[model samples]
Structures are given as C-alpha cells and as structure tokens.
Target: MVTSTLDRASAYTAAAAVLDPEVPVLTIEDLGVLRAVQVAEDGSVDVTITPTYSGCPAMQTIADDVATALAEAGFGPVRVATVLAPAWSTDWMSEDGRRKLSEYGIAPPSPPSPTTGDRRNGPVQLTLGRRPELVACPQCGSTRTRELSRFGSTACKALWQCESCHEPFDHFKAI
Candidate 1:
C-alpha cells in the first residue's frame, strides 16, 4: 500500500509510542532510544534506535516492540536499525521521561555537566573517564544517597541507599 507523508508521521508516532522492554514506565521516545522513524512512499517503515549500552539485552526486545507497534498501527514491513556511532547518553532522555522514571521509583539521569556542553550531541564519552554524578533518592528526594553497589537490579542502574529514607533504590546511571 502506498503511504503519504502524513501516514509516515503517524507511523513514526506509533513506533515511538512503544515502551522500553526493561523499563515499561517510559516509552522508547521517552528514553530517546527511538532515534528516527522514517516511512517510505511504499508504506515501509524504518526505525533507528540506540542502545543505552552496547551489550544491552533489551535491544532485541525493543526492536521487536517497535516493529510490532508500527505494524499494529497499520504500517507494514518495518525495519529497525541500531546506531552506536554517536553513542547514547542519559542526557538524551526527555524531561517527561525523567519525571516518569522518578515516579516509577527509579532515579532519572542527571544532566550532563556544562563543560560537556553540546558534546553529548556528538561523539562518545568514555565511561571510565566519567565521574559518577550525585543521585537523589526517589523515595525521600534526598541528595544524600550512597552507592550500595556499582550494579543494581539492572545493568543500566546502580544500587543506592538514601540517608534520609534509608531506602534502597535503583539509580539510572548517567552515561
């Protein structure tokens, strides 16, 4: 079936609405993983996404979800592409996504340092060189949180405990 630009926009919207497999509270668009959704005049859809981590296990699931969502939205023959050149950053996360994450009991990614500037928009920042940013506790909203472990319940998160609430929470590490 032939599709117009308006249809393409709708297809993009559909695909972008797909939620992250690991974190259901946030959509791919919210997580900034749904990079670009392009629709061809022939009604084919192409979705570009970037993984939070290169070895992220949910990448396949996210791709599948995107394809399924677009197909269900009446867009056919979807192709999902992954791009890692510019790398994914916590900075790419949307403000609404951050709020959703916080509401979901997961600390959202902190903003990139000013020095980093628009550097987050291009190239990749080495994790080893990155200083761990201070994280606020979702429960108590306390900035006085201590890292319990480098790894949390998920690969992308770190385990932290709030001094005020004394509650353990997952912090979405800034990358």
Candidate 2:
C-alpha cells in the first residue's frame, strides 16, 4: 500500500516524541535511537531503532513506548524493529541531547575518538586501564571530577562526583 507523505510524517512525529525511559528529558529523536518510521495506507506503522547497546535493559521499554505512541496517535498495527548491524554510538546522539543531559545535571558523553570511528564493532574493552580522562562536572564545570563507579543509575552512565562543588552526578558514557 502506498503511504502518503502526511501519514509518514504523522507516524514519525508520534514515534519521535517517545522519551527514553532511562532519561526522561530527552526524546528518542534526541537520542538518535528513533532511526526510521514508515507508514502504510492502512495506518500500519513500522519503526526501526537501535539500542544504546545490545542487551540494554531499556530496549524493550523503548519499543513498547514507540508502539504505544503511534497507536495513541491513531496509527495502528505498529511494529518496532531493532537493528544492531551498525551498532549505536554516542556519536549518534544529537547535540540537543547532549545539551539536555548537561542541563539535567548529568555530564554528557565526549565525542567518540575520531581515529577509531567510535569502535562500534569487534571485541569491546571493559576497562579504561589508564588514568581516566578528565570529565568536567555538570554541576560545577570542574575538571577535577572523579568517577565514583563505573556503572551508574543506568548502564550507559557512570557515577561521578565533582571535587570543587562536592556534587555527585551521572556521566553518560561514550560508546
């Protein structure tokens, strides 16, 4: 069935509005997780999304939310598909998403290494193995922040505290 441009736009708007369960401040669009939206004349909609990481606990919730958003917007038979081929990276995150993260008191992820293309494939390194690079604290803008834990409230984030402000915050990890 041929899908009208209007239908496609509507479906995209609905799906894009769905927020990440882990980060309420940023919509899936902002996170760059909402990859594509296709709509049919019958109102069926298909959405393609990539998880922040494979096995990210929020994937299910994100899919469900996307389906719900489309259904609520009068788009039916919603199908949310996951793709892992081009593994998601912090580089996919929008500038607005990064700004929102900082505004929410969470340190935004640094840009992926330019030489490595973000290292989205092959063996994943779990350890820093060296002095962690300085991450400025979102609260005080202090570069003297220390990582409190490798994992934070979510797998995509790490716990950090500022030495200057003595405030604790989450730092979105660059993947």
Candidate 3:
C-alpha cells in the first residue's frame, strides 16, 4: 500500500509523540529534542533531533527508537540526524513538561533569579539572600530537602534527599 504525503507527515507527528525513555514525563517534542521532520520528494523521511546534553548515552537509543517508530509507521529509508548547537537549556522545557517531570518523581528546575550571576568567569559567588529557594519534594510536596550529590544517575540531574519522606530522588538540575 502506498502512503500519501499527508499521511506520512501525520505518521511522523504521531511517532514523535513518544516520550523520552529517561524522562518519561516529557514527550520528545515537549523537551525540544524532536527538531524537524521532512519528507523527501521520493518519500524518504528525515528526522532531526537535538540532544539534551553532549555525551548523553541515551542519544544512541533515542536515535534507534526514532528509526523504529518511523519504520513501524510505514516509512522506509528513515534518517535520524543529531544536531548539536544552541545547547539545550532548562528554559526550553515547557510548562506542561515541568508538571510532568514533577509528577514522575523528578523535581523541575526552579525559576531563575534576577541577581544570579553568570559563573562562566569563575565560581559563582551567590549572596546569602540571593540564593534560590530549594526545590520541593515531588513525593510529599515539602520544601525540606537537601542536596545529596550534584550528580545523579545523569549529569543533568542531581540527587536530593527529602527530609519529610526520608527518600532520595533525582532532581532535574537547572541549566
């Protein structure tokens, strides 16, 4: 059976709806990883994706998943391209994505402060009063939590200890 251009486009859209394996709460689109889908004149499908971070081990799996999804949707000769530029930022995360992250036991990034200095020059010297509020626990919704480690299972996340629940969970670090 031959598929029409419109049908192929719709299929790509549907396939892109799948959520990231690591962060199931946010769909690939919501996370801004699914960049573009273009159907070639000969019916070949090209998918563009931007990794959330460099050296992310999940990227290979994500590419494979994209290919599988397109193949399942009846597309042949699917190409997945990884574009790295304009690095991903927590600000790119959608409001719905943030909510989903919290629901999935990962605390979303806290809002940026006006006085937060850029640390590129040197170590950030935050004034005591300018420190951002602690991220609340996703499980108990308590603000009482302490940083266990700067790095969690992934470099993009941090491990935090929730005092109220006595549980250790990963928090999506603010980029």
**Steric overlap count per candidate:** 0, 0, 0
lDDT tens digits, residue span 65-173, model 3: 8888877777768888898765666656677788888888989986445654332234334244524458899999999999988889888899998999988889998
Q: Which parts of model 2 have CA positions greater than 4 angstroms off?
A: 116-131
What's the TM-score of each model vs. the native? Answer: 0.93, 0.89, 0.80
The sequence of per-residue lDDT tens digits that candidate 2 reaches over residues 52-124 is 8889889899999999988899889999999985778787788899999999999998766654455445543
After aligning candidate 2 to the native by TM-score, how far in Å is the CA of 141 from where it should be? 0.8
Q: What is the lDDT of residue 42 in candidate 3?
A: 67
Ten residues in a row with the worst lDDT in model 2?
Answer: 116-125
On a 0 to 1 TM-score scale, where does candidate 2 land against the true structure? 0.89
Give candidate 3 regions above 4 Å deviation.
1-9, 111-133
Q: How far is candidate 1 from the true structure (C-alpha RMSD, Å)?
A: 1.6
